[model samples]
Target: MTLRLAGGIDVGSCTTKSVIVDDGGNILGSHVLYSGTDFEGASDIAWRETLSLAGVSSTDSICVFSTGYGRNSVSFATNSLTEISCHARGCLHYFSGPMTIVDIGGQDNKIIKLDQKGLRVSFKMNRKCAAGTGAFLEEMALRLRLPLEKLNDLAKQADGEVTLGSYCTVFSGTEVLEKIKSGAALDHIVRGLFHSVVKRILEMDTFTDTVVMTGGVIEHNPFLIDLLKTHIQNDIVTPPHPQIMGALGAALYALQEAPHNMD
Candidate 1:
């Protein structure tokens, strides 16, 4: 018998992610990389890398589903779905029952509420501003002359308290500079930034008893999860491979929607 596989590609604005899974819903391989300027190229690279990691040849027959901001750009996709559906599906894969999903992407953030049956009840998204998204952190990192990856660790080290008054990325960046001039601790400022991100998300919608956080931002900066727990009394959790939840959902959809025999 031939091995059956399904694949998912998420062509996000800032990064592309690919995932492969077996019929049993077990992830076989996954890859994440920057989307850069070419969404097509990025999706191709991510898919190839994911296939390679899964020990599958390029010639293997598989169904591929795509999602994310540039989902339509994935020329190889067998079908496509919205990021909201993908994220909610992905989160439900790990945590059952009703839950709220908070996905902090590079360009925007989403809040998805699912019912006990795992169906979406309502959702919210923030796209008009970058203040609470990954781009905001990246810009602040640049302004602070710090590497983006270092922000999580710096925020973890914060011993003092600081607050950012601006919800606009540009104004917040300026506020960061002013804070620096005032000799505020760098770690404190970073922590404040993380706080701002959590605050922004909280303001978007009310939470359920359980909240599952996903997306690259939360994957890299788990400190944000801890911060969220402090602010909300609900149970906060993260699914395995938090960054690739969308791709995983897409892959699951591929498996469910595709025929068993591709040969």
Candidate 2:
């Protein structure tokens, strides 16, 4: 029996992801890698690797779609779609209704809303600065002399509140140092930093109804979700594979656009 395959490659500011889906939109295989300075190269690496893992050959007539910051740079893609649209579609697959999606990525943060029909109602994004992004958290981790992987664990052990006033990456790093100098516990500062990320997203706009969080930052820092729930006073939803949602959405698009599937 021949298997039908559809693929998506999402090249973001810091990472690239690829996912392959079957005709029914079930994920078959996926891969993720650092984007580095070589967006094109990283995209190629993710794209080919995922296909190989799925036993799908590049020579086959499989459909591939690309999305994210470097979508247009994916020269071999059958088509390119915007990251915002792809993210909304991907989240809808998991949530299955009208909802808001907050995607915190390496360099930017996005607030998107989808209606009951899966149509984009409105959207806002923070790309002008690094504040409240994955980069901001990494910078804070360095300032505290903590390994990036330790941030979540440290946040879980906060002794007291230590809110950061500044949102700029550089300014926040300075604030972290000042808090340290003032004898703030390391865990307190880390938890405060997590709160700051949630604060920045809340400041974006009031997300209505159900809110689903997606992206690499949300996947890595599970503590932020808890903090978000505390601040928003509502339960939050997340996909099992949050980091690759964009690529999954893209693959779904590929399936719809493939010649055999098009009505």
Candidate 3:
């Protein structure tokens, strides 16, 4: 029997991810890497790693789709789709319902509305600043001398309340330091930071009963779930592997492109 393969690559500000899938929509292999040096090089690395994981080579795959900020720079891609479309398609494939997708990436945050069929109907994205993204949290972590994974749990333990000012990450860091100097409790300050970022996301004006949040930050940030519920008055859903949604979405697209009988 001949093997059929298709692939998708997503290059974001801080990471590169790719997926390889068979004609049947089964994920044959996937990989993630840091986007170092430049997006083009990082994308190439992720594509190669993804193919290797699937025990296939780029020459063996018939179709390649590139998404994310660096999609246009991946010359090997047969077609380029915006991450918005690919993410929506990907999320719908897994959840299979009418829902809103909240994707918080390393550098940006987006809200996508999907119909009952899992098709994207509308979307809003905040990319001009790093206020509500993983990068913002990383910066705060560095300044607070706290591990990223511990932030959510620590925030949940706050004994008092504090309000963080500024949406720009750098300014927020400065504000956080000032609060620290003023004798603010660490947990309260941390929870305030969560509120600050969540507020920026709320400004997007997108609300839905069923919402799914994905990305690296959400993977370890339990505080965000409470923050989201408070702002949207809705529960937030997260997949077991929230960080891989983009890559999975890309693979779904590849499956739709490859024509063959795998079942």
**What TM-score does structure 2 among the candidates reach?**
0.95
The sequence of per-residue lDDT tens digits that candidate 3 reaches over residues 1-263 is: 66677788887778888887776767777788888758888887888877787877445445778888787877787777888888887777667668888888888888899888776779988867778888888899899999988889888888765887686888888888899999998989889888887888888757775888887677678578788787676667887667767777776776677656354
Candidate 2 yields a Cα-based lDDT of 0.87
TM-score for all predictions? 0.97, 0.95, 0.88
Report the Cα lDDT for residue 84, model 1: 93
Residues 1-263 of candidate 2 have per-residue lDDT tens digits of 56667889999998999999998888889999999988899998998888788877753668889999999888778999998989887887788667889999988899998888888889999859878999989888887788988998889878676988986888888888899899988899999999999889999988787889999998889888988988785558999999999999998998888767333
Clashing pairs in 3: 90-249
lDDT of each: 0.91, 0.87, 0.79
Per-residue lDDT of model 1, residues 1-263, tens digit only: 66678999988989999999988889999999999999999999999999899988853478999999999999999899999999988888899969999999999999999999999999999968877999999988889899888989999988865899888999998888899999999899999999999998989999986999999999999999989988889998899889999999999989897678655
Candidate 1: misplaced stretches above 4 Å?
58-60
Candidate 2: 10-residue stretch with minimal lDDT: 254-263
lDDT of 2 at 134: 93
Candidate 3, residue 212: the lDDT equals 88
- Evaluate candidate 1 by giving its C-alpha RMSD to the native, one decimal: 1.2
Instruction: Select the stronger candidate by TM-score from 1 and 2.
Output: 1
